[model samples]
Target chain A: MDKRMSIDEVVERIPNGATVAIGGSSISRKPMALVRALARSDRRDLTVIVDVGGPDVDLLLGTGRVAEVIYAFVGFEVLGLAPHFRRARQSQAIRFQEWTEYTVMAGLDAKIKRIPFMPTHATLGTDVLRVNPSFREINDPFGEETLVAVPALKPDVALIHVNYADIQGNGVILGDGHVDVLCAKAAKETFMSCERILSSEELQRFGRDVQILRVYSRGVVEIPWGAHPTGCAPDYRTDLRHLQDYLKAASSEEGWRQYESEFVDVDHPQYLTNHGGPEELVSRLKV
Target chain B: MPLMSEFSVDEVIITTMARQLKGEVLVSSVTAFGSLAAHLAKRLYAPDLAVLSTPESGMDVTPMPTLTLGQFLTDVQQGIPLTMEDIFDAIFTDHFRIWINPSQIDQYGNTNITCIGDWSRPKVALVGARGIPEDTSHLSETFYYILNHSPRSVVQHVDFRSGAGNGESRQHLGPHGAPTTLVTDLGVFDFRGPQGQMTIKSLHPGVSLEEVQERTGFPIGGGEGDILSTPPPTADDIRLIREADPLEVRKLELMSGPMAAEKFVNIYERERQTLHATYPRVGKLGRG
Candidate 1:
């Protein structure tokens, strides 16, 4: 079965008000091309889930597409706090559900195991419990210990970017698979965007790096330099200059609109051209 | 003896943090200052220490002295790559120890990186609690490195508890332990005070105990005669720190405002120069 599709098709499958889990941590390996496409699309009321978000979460929120965000941390690492996310949260422009990195994983673990909830001692003594009242405290059935019950967070769609993928939906991540596998397992459907599409035989050469099997994916789209601005590991590094530009533009409403019109509203090829070109991006971003 | 004027306060904090590690498995985030301490400790004190870099999910990473951006990418390429799930599981083990950097810490050592004021509508929304809760709760000995130690940072009470500390609130929270020590610009503190309050362990050279108390929001333990002077970094320690971070990226945490911005630009320029010098053909890709 050829499970390949265009970026537009993947975005079309995700309806408005859908719960979407984005793969990547902070400023590495984020599916930015697909995220940009989603931003260009008229999708609205998205409840986005991420462990450590970077520009992807900020872009969605900046475009007013996201209604809520369920996340552990969302910042630009050393670059400073995410301007759009900070603005949205401070002004009460969007609702947010906060969880620690462990609880976020535990919630996904519950979904993967097909359980109602997973018990953990993560947020017991913290005020994170007060903000998120849905997470209940209960005694272990088998033991006498109190634990926070993290409910299963089942996303309707999971968007992941990888280094390589075959037409059969097998994906390979050259770098750390930061919760991307868990997102694929827990989501109802998973779509992958890859920098390159290889043959089944070529995919096998990656050995253990082929962490995403065909069974876990619904569709795979070939989008070279897909994780640009962020990174695709041994292939390229983050375009910090571009991120600094993004930070400056995202600081204000007018600047954000100007940025969207130039970067987010355009097609992927044009977007590549705007960043110089494929050659420039590959040479510059390539590790 | 390295003179007090020879090293910055950041170097003192880094050496102090490095001294606390005993060749244990150390998990570190992408923060520049904390990661430097971990590297320094591994290099000088704890050669056998396993440094697990999080978010990137690299194990035993001996990273370049560049900031988090350069270091994390280098870590992914050089270190053994593991999945985030693998890292999450490793945190619960007995060998797991981590060093964290939080925005705010209270008298009882509870940390808050979530918000500044109210939870419903925060005055300033900092980054949400990342892994502090889980790391502090599970690890037997967790360490902290606060770059700036003002009343705002060391508060009387945290607005939100991102990491469980040695406070009254943590009594019923299973078998979790409080933070072992907090390495700050002023000095070193531990939770060995009365009722597990943050007590002064050592005052940095030239930093009086009165100054530390005045800067702290709550009353600190270890008054006057009890306070010990933080040992200055030896000449060998200074040489190793400078060798590990030639561009002086550790100084970024110690600076704020326009000073930090100027320093960041300078560091990036130096990094780009080093990159271009090494790979001449890789110069055409616009200023990164």
Candidate 2:
């Protein structure tokens, strides 16, 4: 009856080569604990669906757990490129499907709506038609105009981190959650890591719009500071210094290994201790 | 004294980009280095301009420098925000113009941010077509900024079509306009030449017409037609820019070779303001 599990336990359920989508925008509020767990594990050949992804994609790509990346863009926000992802792409070690925000959203909407495909004008005049075969161009039935029909994206699993969740797996998203809701709705299996494990009644204190409900989520875990370094807005700010350090470390193999060892090699409990645990983050929360 | 003298390449490009935003568009959005130019335009010339400051920043009343994701969060914390849906809808509405940076631009005005080789696969992988599809094909006006211009970037045919220009595949595509201006380190280019291929509207101060053609992957401005050149930025423009981008973080993205000894003073003074008080000295430089 209880859906709560440890970070490692939830990640263990994801098989190698699974197509997974991680929530949050670019560098903001990523599911870093779950991501770190996946990286630490022996999972291989993952295809990550991401928009505005930073370390979520870069860390997995660096660890060689990724086979492909589906992204609108993946860079270090403004600190330049995602070093590990860029290195892998330059060597052709990775495969990617370049998409716009609309194409990816449309793809997810198809699965959420249980439709075969979603038609959009996003790729009508662009080279996305040629670059990605995942979408097909067909003439509109009512008119002569060309419309692109993007295939549905039903990832094998979704790894999302939210600010709050109940033991039964309802989640509370705090800020500008770009496509996380659609991602959860579209994903076949959804695993979440949250800052707090609240009661179903406590979740009601939030207005109806924030919660992602138990039906869409498969499992949830309570891991304080779970999305550290990456901002969990309405909670702690993005640890800029930590992100900068990671950026520097990721630029080289030796540095990345050191960073991975320092952060990812440990369990969620141990990792939380290194980052001043839950108390420090509690005071920083905007709410 | 000449109003247009003793300005750096960075200032010229900034002014050129700022002027491009001068027309009647109520809102302007720019990505990467283009945002700094947009910021300057709002302060200096286009006081009425509303900027979608960062990539995530939609219509904000104030122009805060959100050069990073962290700053973007700050904007959201303090400002009235736009949802991802609203931002995308605005692209189709045609009220605002977008200024984007392209990895490769073809003669017909098509741009590519997809992989540099065969679609099946090969060569360098660039940042995929994020907004190029919507911005290039749907927005009212779209301009481009190329930091490093060379034969590889200005090509005959892009390896994969990320943004549609005036190519054969886009002939029937309507409601999509070609880019208004293609500003680069070398010069400002447009698609006014025969058959809508790129041609030189104006060459930069130090650059030559022959050099531009030689470096271009496709032919431009020669048999196509006579090329025109515009005057460089005035001293007043330089002062405005120096005050605007006090941090001179943009210099890293645009400055080539060296500016004279005096240009160093502006860069140092502005950078110091951030290094000392705004942020820890080490944190402020690349942080912006």
Candidate with maximal DockQ:
1
Q: Per candidate, chain B TM-score?
A: 0.88, 0.79
Instruction: Write model 2 residue lDDT over B1-288, tens digit each, in one string.
Output: 233357777777878888878644445443435666676677677776667644544454444343332233333334455456666777777656667777788888888876678655546666667777877657756788787788889888888778878757466567365666898888998877667778788877767877888888987863345555656777677787776556665655554323422343344334334423443322111233
Candidate 1 lDDT over A45-70, as tens digits, reads 99999988989999999888999999
Which digits, one per residue and each the tens of the lDDT, describe model 1 over residues B25-103? 6455566666667777888888877775544456676654564354334433456676666666777774566678889
CA error at residue A157 for candidate 1, angstroms: 0.2
Predictions in order: lDDT? 0.81, 0.72
Q: After best superposition, candidate 1 residue A38: deviation in angstroms?
A: 0.8
Tens digit of per-residue lDDT, candidate 2, span A149-266: 8888879898888888888888887556677888888898899899888888777666653558788889999987888768775465555456667876876779988888888888
Candidate 2: docking tier:
acceptable
**Number of the top-ranking candidate, with TM-score as the measure:** 1
Residue B11 accuracy (lDDT) in model 1: 81
**Displacement of the residue B51 alpha carbon in candidate 1, Å:** 1.4
Chain B TM-score of candidate 1 stands at: 0.88
For candidate 2, the lDDT comes to: 0.72
> Considering only chain A, what is the TM-score of each predicted structure?
0.98, 0.94
Off by over 4 Å in 1: B53-56, B69-78, B257-266, B269-288
